[model samples]
Target: MNVKNIFAAVAILAATGSAFAQQTEFVAPDAAFQSRLTRAEVRQDLAQATAEGTTAQRQHDGQDTVYAAGGRSRQDVRAEAIRAASIRHYGDVNDTYFGG
Candidate 1:
């Protein structure tokens, strides 16, 4: 390699190494840290929040809180899915149906 190319490569590597070396380090909390609330008090507060329906609720994908009383049942949905799968085309339409 030429002197300029070797020097450019070294400079780029040095810059990257310096940038990585100057990253911030993680510092742990103090050993004397204490909680303001007791375990029993925290538990009671959590229970009260849960009873009042104020706790955070995580809904999974495709799930919602609303309920439909007259919705389709599990068996109905499964049968419909099976029927649809049985009639679904798994091959090319033009090649299978036409003389291609």
Candidate 2:
């Protein structure tokens, strides 16, 4: 209404806009995990695993699956990627959670 109130409102709006923009630009650790995955491959693995059971169960069931090899499974890779990104972005994972 008045000049002082208008300026205060504009300042508050500017601060809020900047904070929202910063948050949108910020990438979460889970986003980094998803970004590293090949969507097609991950989807296929997930579908197959879901159709059967767990990936490990499918492997034990004598199904020659791509994920049965001696490497990290899709979930493991995703988890590790998230953990790495969290450590990179936040300095430490446990510290971020525990406030240490």
Candidate 3:
């Protein structure tokens, strides 16, 4: 082989060797997969649960108001119907979330 061809081969070999050197291995933390969640994470979960509950309550109230409204054609009666339902809804508000 010519000297130029030999030099090209050596360069290719050197580049290939660098690829192996650049590789890295990962290791788990000292506690591994048994790590406990942080306090902030727990707080986040609780907050999320609370928000979800509130959203569900709102959705329920919306559905009840819609039902009470009867139909969209009677828009004039809708507000009155919802207002009347609020009286009973006050009593229904008794739940764990409200400290009941």
Best by TM-score: 1
Q: Please, what are the lDDT tens digits per residue for candidate 1 over residues 49-71?
A: 99999999876777667976868
Summing lDDT over every window of 10 consecutive residues in candidate 3, give the lowest-scoring window.
60-69
Q: In model 3, where do residues sit more than 4 Å from their true spots? A: 20-100
Task: Give every collision pair in model 2.
Answer: none
Shift in Å, residue 54, candidate 3:
8.0
lDDT of 3 by residue, 1-100 (tens): 6999999999999999988885377665674566479989988987998988853444343334333434555666888788886654446566677554
lDDT of 3: 0.71
* Candidate 2, 1-100: lDDT as tens digits: 6999999999999999887664447666676453557889889989998888876543366565475355668899999889986874454457757655
TM-score of each: 0.45, 0.24, 0.27
Off by over 4 Å in 2: 22-100
Give all candidates' CA lDDT scores.
Answer: 0.84, 0.75, 0.71
How many times do residue backbones clash in model 2? Answer: 0
> Which candidate would rank higher by lDDT, 2 or 3?
2
